[model samples]
Target: MAMGHYVNYYRLEMAQQREEEGEEAGVKRSAQYMALLTGPGFTGHVLALILFLMVTSSVERVRRKGFETFWYTHHLFILFFITLMFHGAFCFIRADTPPYCKSSPGSYKFVLGSLFFYILERTVREIRARLPTAISKIVLHPSKVLEVQIKKSSNQHGDGFFRAKAGQYVFLNCPDISAFEWHPFTITSAPEEDYVSVHIRIVGDWTTAFAKRLGCSFDDEQQFWIEELKNRTSNGVGGGEETISGVGVGAASGSSSAVAMDSMAFGSGASLMGGAKQRASASANSLQLQRPTEPTITLPRVLLDGPYGSPSEDAFNYEIAVLVGAGIGVTPFASVLKHIWYSVMQPTKIITLRKVYFFWVCRDRDAFEWFQDLLIALEEQNLTGFLEIRSYLTGELGKEEMDTVLMEARAAAAAAAARHFRNKHYYGGGGGDGADVGNQGFEGKGGEGDLLTKLHKPLGGSGAFPMEVMLGEEMNGSNETLSDARRDRDAITGLRSPTYYGRPNFDKIFGELALAHPQEHGQVGVFFCGPKPLGKTLHRCARKYKFKFHKENF
Candidate 1:
């Protein structure tokens, strides 16, 4: 029905046009009709298809290359919108233009508010990105994990302290990195903590480059600068048109150069061509300027943009929560664990979370070192049995070797416990019974730095967490250090149960949780951030046992 009506309307229009423009002229105009194909409308339509391709074709590459292709290509949206505006406001075929269409003019007025808000939001974001953020602490961890701990700049943070929920994240930008790219990482510190921290695992291209920048020398940095500039051509900086237009422009510096740049930003045709020549010439001049002899400070200027909420942000809402992470994905739960730790220590802190089960599954043993200190400390304090952490190491090792690892882990725990006891005893002088369990106090993070260091102190064999069992010597020296009753000590640490050798049995784990928390028919918040496959398995388990499961992925 619609096609028949359009056909009749088209015939009427052609007949009217024939009468007004005489038959010969009307026929010639019909032959030349290509209104939508050669102007802004065509450009906008082409850009739409390009953007669709960008989103669809780069799906796999985005995962491997750290979103660079997606990030850079997505900027074409600016051109897309601009061309769309031009396309809508102008008309090539003018049959309806004299008294415009009654139904609608164009989409511009309708989207004005949305466009303005987006522009405002981006302007604020760019302003925030321009500020320099200081990294207060850099804790280099094993397994290529680098933690850049930064404090909120008082001048920049403004008003109150920078606040975030347990499982939120922030977008990080480093000028030395790409100047435009920002990556997201989970907030690993508690909201109440003085400093904010992001644990970056050296995995993708951007992270690897950042690691290089941190360790490179002065000469290496200069070389990197040249290479980085050259790479910018493909990264959406340099252009053939700019190079051509900038030809024969004068020096790299001057008022005329500034004028040329401004002209280039808004000019077109021959004027734009000349401006591009000037810009390219200026760029070449810049490349020739003598390098600073005194190496400029090489520390990359990093900026932060958000404390955006993720799915796991609501973990505190549920009384019974299960926080799970695998590999670097454990960062979100770190914040939750810290929060839970504080809640356990300070009984008066108002919070709904009564219990938290943290599970960290890793592929390498060295990865355990990242959170070992914090988790061990949590276990040593026993935090009223409110926090339970479970680590699964899926590395390839024999049963005997696995047993050795388990024994070593237990012994490590026992040693930490002894240290907690002796550190207090020494602080109280030699008068108190060092082994007195009633006097144990591991409530606050005040002495966190000294927590492990105090363990290194010689307690004159009064042995809080002792150096009696050295894991290094035992693991290397013999197969004889393995224990039969090592399973008994698995429950010793509140941080985690025994480190399991393989993957977890999700069905069994959820069943146990469901049984334990069934008294009030309470909901168990199963929060996870990890591989999609594991999350899917967890989702099935949640559905089977009637638990609410939430996950956040990058």
Candidate 2:
């Protein structure tokens, strides 16, 4: 559309030059004369063209990298639209006849209504976003995923709280980070929850910087663990409990121990308050935890523009819903699943769907930490057998990685035990008196618990071990095939459903769904949020199975 408009405008300029000058003079100076016509109309066209090219080029140039570049360039639309109102003001395009062809500034008239609405929309959004919004909480998960919880304060009348349905999104603008940049993120928290939350994977510059500002540090070489080991040999003041936050974040396969950071500056006056253990305790099942210290940091002001509708918002309308997410694409499904859990847990709540199948395909096992707790919570309720979750890890976990996790677990357990023994003899600390020092090595009922259980913290008492141990060395018969299979715990996620090694077999999955829900069950709705290629594959499957398909338009 823009190209066609520009082509016509260029022809009009040529015609106008011919009328102003003689045909002979126009032919002699067509290019120079056209360039010299620096009226508002011609200048607007040029500016619009430049803005269009810059925006399009920046999107491709950044690829998966520079988010700031794309964000800044995309805002050129404001200037582009302003220029467009004057694009044909001078009326260069002359009619065939004379009297009807008088130059009149009518371009603005053509766009006046739309421009008014556009301005009005932005004005309303800006005013609403600025109204007393606060960052309630922030959680830094593995794989550089940051979860932010936002709370909206109501007016004096106790009205105007932000309301949204499941599978919706919001435009977030943090002025402390960037004054003009606003990014859209799926709302992972359900409408039933009091606060709105979003899970952001720290991939681009804006996101990486945002995570760091929220108290997470990144490292390429070290796997940072947050362990809260209560020191028995306390300070002379009172032996009060101390909480330390770990600074480094890297791949889960790293062998190095955690790096503890105290008084780490995050936001303005903000310090690290809770350890990862406390953070895990405050997952989807739990939202708040009492910290030992009152947090002094003032969280950055974040403006939110929406709880906008999305394709996945229509998920519950279907009798059978198949939700497919890839990596951070699982964010939208988080809301869907949470809403489903709420609906199922409360019998009075009405929901259209009778069955749901959620498939998450991620590259890293640690990435599962982003939404594993929510999935586990839903699983615990059984949801009346209405929901099924199948997770796939496309990335290969080599044997060496498994061995490294095992070694790290052993080292951590040994270190904790050594501390316990040292404290017991030197500080006269007693064992099993319910102190953290005493239970460091024996948190589980059985022998030395593995790091997998510690990392994920499954709801079950006897959680998963890193790997199978030798015959006599096994703590609770970890080598028994029947018992291990019965445990139904993935070594990585520690969930009842084991994570698949490679890509999911979509054909088999679709075939089973088709067989299970025949035509009588009504059309199955397949909602997906992922890359274009996987969406295409799913679209094909949907077509072959005669199901409705919906892909999120990010």
Candidate 3:
């Protein structure tokens, strides 16, 4: 709509210029147009058009590569609006100029109200940005993600602290980096916390310099380690047993239908690359090491502009919410997850959210190592049935291929077990303590009592969630006490939720959710912050399933 308006206005301006110049003899239209450009009204008209074109192009995908260009060009609206008003008020050219020119007609009346509102909005924003603010802490995570914690004092609110909802974003500016540059980042910290926080992925020049100012620069050795970590997943060095906690059994069952867990055992081939794997692991660890939170020197003064609303902020309004985040797009969901934890922890806070399915898709495990501890902690909490996390690693094998390979590995393991069964007496086999409970058919009822005895930390309020109840009636023969089952931890992050090897199947996931919640046709909310391709896929699925879809637009 905006583009069409701009094009139409440009065409009309050109036609009027031709018409005005055609009235004069021996004056070429091109030469006359250039001459008119130096005049007051014509100058503003041409300047406004140029500003619109530059700002429009920069705001597109071009911002990803050159954000400084986008930021500077976008702010030209101040000049563009002023020039627009000047172009209208001058009224240098007109139709039927004899009578119209006598009256000194202008477009100022048409634009005055909107221009006034625009100025008022910026004034309020400027005042809010100048409010008391200071950097509380800074941590550099893996993948060059910078976490900044800011403490703010607000005079307008009675609480005297800056307040912003989870899943919202803020525009940050540091005079030390560039006095005029401001970048937007999603707030990763919950509002209940004392300070506001934002996780910035250092992808642009502004963010890179910002990280350096905070003492997050990596030495040569550290940079070498980062390169090695990228190739670690494919060398067969990553391996871990898969376990399903009793609290998350239903969610596991639902996910297993779409994504299969990796069960491929390593051989001599993996051992040959042991040194490389260790170095990669060590590098990842070094990158994740805590930097000095408070520097000896004074920290740079930072200004914040918003507690602005985003689509993901509406997540709590729905009874069932599905959050899909890809790469750094997971930032908003981090805030939402923390908010959910706080809301559930406090009994006084009432919310409509009952279940949340969070899907985090990263290219590799190292990309999201910083988020692992949070997931592990959330898994240990009492809100077991409320939250289910699924992390996908798309760097190595794909989903379908990984499933096929796992099937082949399971068959090979079965053949080896058969050979060992015949020589039990020679091997001195007397082990039946349910230590290998998760290694085989975990959905069976054979070792319920023994597995329950082995579980040390049962999830939820009481320790009697009933393994049979979670596994359903088919596995319900034991009268033994029920507790949370042991989880299958991921080798990369040590998260209880096993990471899949590829992208998710939105159709299958949405189909399962639709089946589970028949009454929530329009009530089920699907909030996504990710790449455009995946977001479009989710949007289509939402329509097919009759669910509400909200996407985070930059």
> Which candidate ranks first by lDDT, i.e. highest?
2
Give the C-alpha miss distance for residue 392 in model 2, angstroms: 1.2
State every prediction's TM-score relative to the real structure: 0.64, 0.70, 0.67
**Better model by TM-score: candidate 1 vs candidate 2:** 2
Candidates in descending TM-score order:
2, 3, 1
Q: Rate the local accuracy (lDDT) of all candidates.
A: 0.57, 0.62, 0.60
Q: Report the number of the highest-TM-score candidate.
A: 2
The segments of candidate 1 whose C-alpha lies over 4 angstroms from its true place after superposition are: 1-24, 28-36, 57-63, 90-105, 130-132, 155-161, 216-297, 398-496, 520-522
Tens-digit per-residue lDDT, 1-554, candidate 3: 43454465566556654333445744434433433553543755567576666767676578888888877777776676567656644444455645444355455777688889988987877887777776665554565676777875656655754688989998898887987787888998888888888888888889888877655565574454344333343343333311111111010111223222121111111211112222233332222222223313345678888888999999989999999999889999989998877776775668998899998888744565656546656887866689987766665433433333233334333443454453443565545543352343233244453221232332222422211111211111221221122233333334555555446778878888899899988789999998899999999999999999999974
Ten contiguous residues minimizing lDDT sum, candidate 1: 262-271
lDDT of 2 by residue, 466-486 (tens): 343211112122211100111
Q: List the residue pairs that clash in candidate 3.
A: 243-488, 246-485
Instruction: Give the 10-residue window scoring lowest on summed lDDT in candidate 2.
Output: 230-239
> Model 3, which residues run further than 4 Å from truth?
1-41, 88-100, 103-105, 154-158, 221-295, 397-487
